[model samples]
Target: MNENKKPTLEICLTPDAVSFIDLTGKIAVIVDIFRATSCMVAGLASGVTHVVPVASVEDALSYKSEGYVTAGERNGEKVEGFDIGNSPFEHMEQEFKKIVMTTTNGTQAIEAVKNTAEQVVIAAFLNLKAVTSYLKSQNKDVVIVCAGWKSRFNAEDSLFAGALALKLKGDFWWEGDEILFSTHSYSSVKNNLSKILKHSSHYKRLKEHGVENDMDFCLEIDKFKNVPILKGNILENLAK
Candidate 1:
C-alpha cells in the first residue's frame, strides 16, 4: 500500500473478476443487494446468532444434524428441502441460533474472496451505514465485491457497489471505472432505488418465486446497524 496515497477502494463487479485483483490485506465488503447479504444483516439484527455461508446445497444441508437449520435458494427459488428461502423477512420472522445457507450467487461470491481478504464484511442497503462505518474504522484499502447474478454482471449489485462507494469517497481513493460509474449512477437514483430497480432481472426472477416483499425489504437503507463479520467459517454480529 502506498501510504502517500489515500486508502484505495474499488469494486469487483462479479465473482469471475475476483481472481484478477489482489485481495490480501484489504477489507472486502461483500454486497449481494438482491438478497443474501440483506438476509444476513437482518438475521443478526433479529437475534439469530450466526450464518454459515456455503457454496453448495450439499454443504448447507450437512449442518442439519448438528442442530443448524438450513436455508437457501437456487435460481431464485428456495431449495425444496430447506427450512427457509433467502429472504430478509424470513430472517426477521424466524428464531434460530445458527444457520447454514447457500444461494445462487451470494455464497459463490463469498467463496471467491473469503480466504484472500484480510477481513470480509457483509453489506446490504439494510446495513449500509454499518458497513461504511466498519470500513472507515479499519482505514484500510477496500474492495466492494458485488455478487452479480450467477457469474455475470447484474444491475442491482452494481447499484449497491455504487451506493457504498458514494459513502466512502471521502476516506478512500477511488480506484476503478466501476467505482466511478456506480457512484454517479447511484447518486441519481438513490431516492428512487426501488423504482429504478423494479422489474429488473433479479427482481423479476425473485418475483416469479413469490418473494417480491423480500426485494422490498432488501432495499431499505440503514434498517439495521449490525455488521455481519466473517470469522472463520461463519459470520457473526455482536452488534446491538
Candidate 2:
C-alpha cells in the first residue's frame, strides 16, 4: 500500500495453480487469449450488458430460463443445445443483454480467484492497452492468471501475461517463475504474434475446427478500447 514502493506482478500460468496463488489485495487479470476472455471483451464492446462466466456448461445452462443467452464450448466446439461457441466473432454478431458463458479454461480461472482477489479483470490481446492502463491507474499489486489449455500450460495465455508484465514494468516489480518465462516469451514474439501462435496447441485445435478467423481477431492488440472487469460474478464494461 506504499505509494513510493512499486506494486508487484505475479503470474499463475494455469488454472490448476490458481489454488496456490494468494490473490488477497491484488488485482487479478484473467487471460484466456485463444478465445474465452477475448469473446468477453468483444461481447462487452459490442453492446452486451454483462457476461456471467460459469465453470461448466451445466452452470451456464442454468441461466437459460432467466433469458440469458447461453454460450460456451467443450473441446473447441460449441456445446450441444447452447446458443453459441467461445468465438469472439460469434460474440460480436449478437446483441444480447446478458450472456452466461463457460469454457474449458477461462471461466474456471475466473471462478478460481473470484472470492480471493480484491478485483478481477478479464484481459486478452484485444484490449491489452486498456487493461494495462487501468491496472496501472489502480496502483494495486497484480496477479496475471493465464487460462491455459485444459489446466495445462499454453503459449497464447502466457504470452499475454508476458505482454502485460512488459507493459507494467515501469509501474510494477515483476515476481514469480511464470512472470520471468512470460516476459521472455512475450519479448520473443513481440513482432509476430500470429506467426508464433499458429504452432500453439489450442491454435491448431481451433484451426482444425475452422475458426482461424477467431484466432486472428483475438491477437490484434487493443482492438477494443474497453476493459471487462468482474464484479460479483458478472463481467461488466469498465469503459462505461
Using all chains and alpha carbons, the TM-scores for the candidates as numbered come to 0.97, 0.96
Model 1 spans with C-alpha error above 4 angstroms = 238-240
- Model 2: ten consecutive residues of lowest lDDT: 1-10
Each prediction's RMSD over C-alphas, in Å, is 1.2, 1.4
Tell me the whole-model lDDT of each prediction, alpha carbons only: 0.88, 0.90
List, residue by residue over 1-240, the lDDT tens digit for candidate 2.
545598888898888787886788999899999899999999999989899999987888999999999999988999999998888877887567799999988998899899999999999999999998899999899889998988899999999999989999889877777888899988998898899999988899889999988999999999899989998988999855
Clashes of each: 0, 0
Give the best candidate by lDDT: 2
lDDT of 1 by residue, 125-199 (tens): 988888888888887998889999888998899999998888887888888799888988888888988998985
